[model samples]
Target: MKNLIAATYAPMHTDGSLNTDKIKDYSQFLTKNNVSGVFMNGSTGDFTSLTIDERKAITLAWSENKSKDLYLIDHVGDPSLKVAKELAQYASDKVDAIAAIAPFYFRLNSIDKLIDYCKEIAICAPNLPFYYYHIPVLSGAQLNMASFLEQAKDNIPNLAGIKFTNNDLIDYGHCKSKANSKYNILFGYDELFINSLPLGATGWVGSTYNHLAPLYYKIKELFENGNMEAAADLQSKAIKFVELLNSKGGFNGVGKGFMRVLGVDCGPSRFPHTTLSDSDYIEIKEALDGIGLKSWFSK
Candidate 1:
C-alpha cells in the first residue's frame, strides 16, 4: 500500500458499452508498469456514467486478476444510499477494499450527515476496509476531514481512513494527525505529490500513475535522496504531463486515450469525454517527447 495506485479508466467499445474483456490486459499492463493497486469505478473510471450492473461487472472483472501484487478497491458511491449499499455489498467479497463518496446530488450539509451516510454504506461491506472518498470539489461535501475522522472513528466500524482528494493541506495535515496517526490517509491530489511527502504520505491513488508510474517512483527516489531541487524538477515534469493532456481536452478523457499510446488500448472514453483520433495521439506523443517525458513513461 506504500506504492502508487492507479485510478483506472472504464474501457468502452465503439458503441459505448462495457469492455470487461479488456480488463485482463489492463490489469497486466498496470502490473508491468509497477502500479501496486487500482481504484476501480472511481472518478477516473467514470463511475457516474456507468450503471450499477456495469460497475459490478468491473469489480468482478478486476477481481479475477486480483493478486498479492495488484490490490483492488471498488468505489461504490452513488447519490442514492440504497444503490451505494448494493454496490458495496456486491464488491465486499470481490475486492480488497471499498470506498464511497458523499452523496453528490443532495450533498451532506454537515459532518454528522456525511458520517451517517458512510456508516450505512460501510456496514454493507463489514468484512472489507471502508474508505471515504473526500473529493469535496466534485461531491460538494466540503466538511473538514479531520473532524469527520475524530467523530466517525466511533461510529463506523470498518473505517480504514480517507482518500483525501482535496488540495487543502491544512485539512489534510489535521486528518493525518487524527486518532494518534492511526488512519491510512492516502493522498489523492496528484499534482501536489511533492507537497504531501514532507507531511508523511507513503501511499497515493491517482490517474497519472497509469501513465507515469516509473516517473513518480523516480520522483520519490530523488526526494528521499535529499535532492529537493531534482525532485521538484521531476515533479514539474509530471505536472506537465497532466497539463499537456488537459490542454487537449479534459484530463479524464484525453489521458485515457494516451493509454493506447503506451500499448494498452483502453479504447475511447464514454459520452461527455473527448475521444482522440490516431492523428491526435501522433501530436500528443510528439509534444510529450518535446517535454522530455517519453523516456519516463510507464514501461
Candidate 2:
C-alpha cells in the first residue's frame, strides 16, 4: 500500500515444494535490504508449478517472518477461482494486499468475462486490497484499459490498482491516461523503472529487484532528485545485467542462479524450467565480479 518497490519470488525448490525456511530467510533478507514490498507466488515464483498447500506455506512463512515495515503482496493467481479465493482468505491478515491474474489457459474473449472473474476474486477477499495483474502476453487475456476502468468503477471497491507487466509502453501509457490518479500503477518490468516512474507509475515489481534492490534504490533516488543522466546510466547497467540473465533462459534458471551465486542456496528451479549450464554460471559470476558485487557470491 505504501509506494511499493517490490520483488517477485523465485521458486525456492526444484521438487515443487514450498521451502518455508528459505522463504522466511529471503523475506527477512528483503526486509533488511530496504525493499518496500514483495509479490509472492508470482510468475518468477512458479506459482503454476506449485500446489495450493505449497503456495499457502510460502505465504504463511512470509507472513510470519515479515516485518511490519515490509509490505506483502500475495499473488494468489490460480486457474481455479475456488483455490484463489481460499488462498486469499488464508493470506488476508498476513499480507498487505492480494493480487491475481485473470484466469488463463481458457480463452475468455470478452472483457465482460474478465471483469466478472476479477469481481468474483474481489468478492472473496473484500477486506484486502486487490491488485489486478495485467500480464496479457503470459495470461492470454487482452485487457483493454477503457473497459476495465468502466467495469471496476461500477463493480469493485477493493480494486486498489494494477501490476501492469506488458512490454508495450503504449499500453502502460494508455492505462495511465484512463486510471484515476489515486490508483497505484506498478510497473512489473524492472528495465522500465526510470521511464515508467515519470509516467505516474507509483513503483516497480520484478524478480531482478530481489537481488539488485540496492541498485534500484539508488536509481530511484537519482530519478527523484531530477538527475536523469545519472539515473539513466544506472538503469542501463541494471538493464544490461537483466539482459545477460535473460540470455541464459530468463528467470527460471538465471534468477535461481543469481540467488545461488549470492549464497542464498535457493536450489534448482522446477523441471520444465531448465537449470543453468556451467558456462552460464561462470558468465553470471564474471558479471557479478565485474560489478564489484563478488561479495554476494561469498558464502
Candidate 3:
C-alpha cells in the first residue's frame, strides 16, 4: 500500500453538532486538491466533543463523496471500548483504514496495557488495517519505539503502522529504523514535513491540510522528486504560516478561522473555543494576504 498524505479534523456547525454537508464538502475539497487521504474525528477533529453517532455520520459522509482515487482513514478513538468498537464497525466499509489513539483520559502505565487496548480494537474489526495513533501529549500514554515494538510486534497482526505526533525526531528516527518495510510511519506535524520525510517518514497527518492542501502537496512533490532545496523553501513558507496561526491561538480557533476564510461553511468551534477575536481575524487575514493565499478565502 502507498503511504498516505492525509489531514485530520472534524467539521462542526455553529451549534456544535456534526455538520454532515460540510464534512462531505470538505472531503470533496481535499480529493479535488489531491490529498491522498483524510482522517475524520481525530484529536484535531475535536473527537472529545462528538458523540459516537456523530462521528459515524461524518465518516459516512466522507465515504460517500470520496472519489475512487482517494482514501479515507477514520479515527475511532474513544474512552469506551464498546463505543470505539461500534464506530470501528460502522466505518469498516467506509474507509480504507481505521486508526485510534490509546484510550486517553486515563494513564496507561505500561506498554502492555497500550498493546492490549490496540489488540481489543483490532479484534473488533478484523479485516480493517488498524493504525496506532500516537500523540502522547494528549493521550497521557508514553510510548517509545522499543516499548511499541516489544509489545505490538507479535500480538497486533493488523497493526498497519503509526501516526507519530510527538515532536521528538530522535524517537521518530528510532521508530523508522525499527519498523519493517510493511509498516508505514506517518508524521503528525505539518511544520516538520521537510525534516520528517528525509528521516524515513512515509506519510503525514495534520490539521492545516484542510485549508492548504495545494501547498502541502507541492512540498511533498518537491521532496519526492529529489529537490530538497525547493521542498525546504516551501516548508519554510508553510512553517511561517503555521507559526502565525499558533501565535493567534491554538488549532481550534485558528483552524475555524481558516475554514471561515476559505468559505467552506465549517462554522465556529464548540464552546471552550470561542469565535476568533477581531484582532485574531485581522492577523489571519494579513498573514494569508501576505502569502498570496487570500484567494482561498475569496468567494
Q: Provide the overall lDDT of each model, using Cα atoms, as 2-decimal numbers.
A: 0.92, 0.76, 0.76
TM-score of predicted structure 3: 0.89
| Pairs clashing within candidate 1 | none
Candidate number that wins on lDDT, 1 or 3:
1
Clash statistics: count for each candidate: 0, 0, 2
List model 3 lDDT by residue over 78-168, tens digit each: 8888888888888888888889898787778788888888888877778888998998988888878546965798999988888888888
lDDT per residue as tens, model 2, 119-225? 88877778988898888888888867556766787777888888888777887887777776757778888878888877767678887777777777777788889
lDDT tens digits, residue span 60-177, model 1: 9999978778989899999999999999999989998999999988888999899999999999999999999999999999899999998998899899989999999999988887
Query: 1 or 3, which is superior by TM-score?
Result: 1
TM-score of each: 0.98, 0.89, 0.89
Candidate 3 CA-lDDT value: 0.76
Q: In model 2, what are the clashing residue pairs, if there are any?
A: none
Best model number under TM-score: 1
Q: Where in model 2 is the C-alpha error above 4 Å?
A: 2-4, 10-16, 277-282, 291-299
In angstroms, the error of model 3 at 100 is: 1.1
Candidate 3 runs further than 4 Å off: 1-4, 224-230, 277-283, 291-299
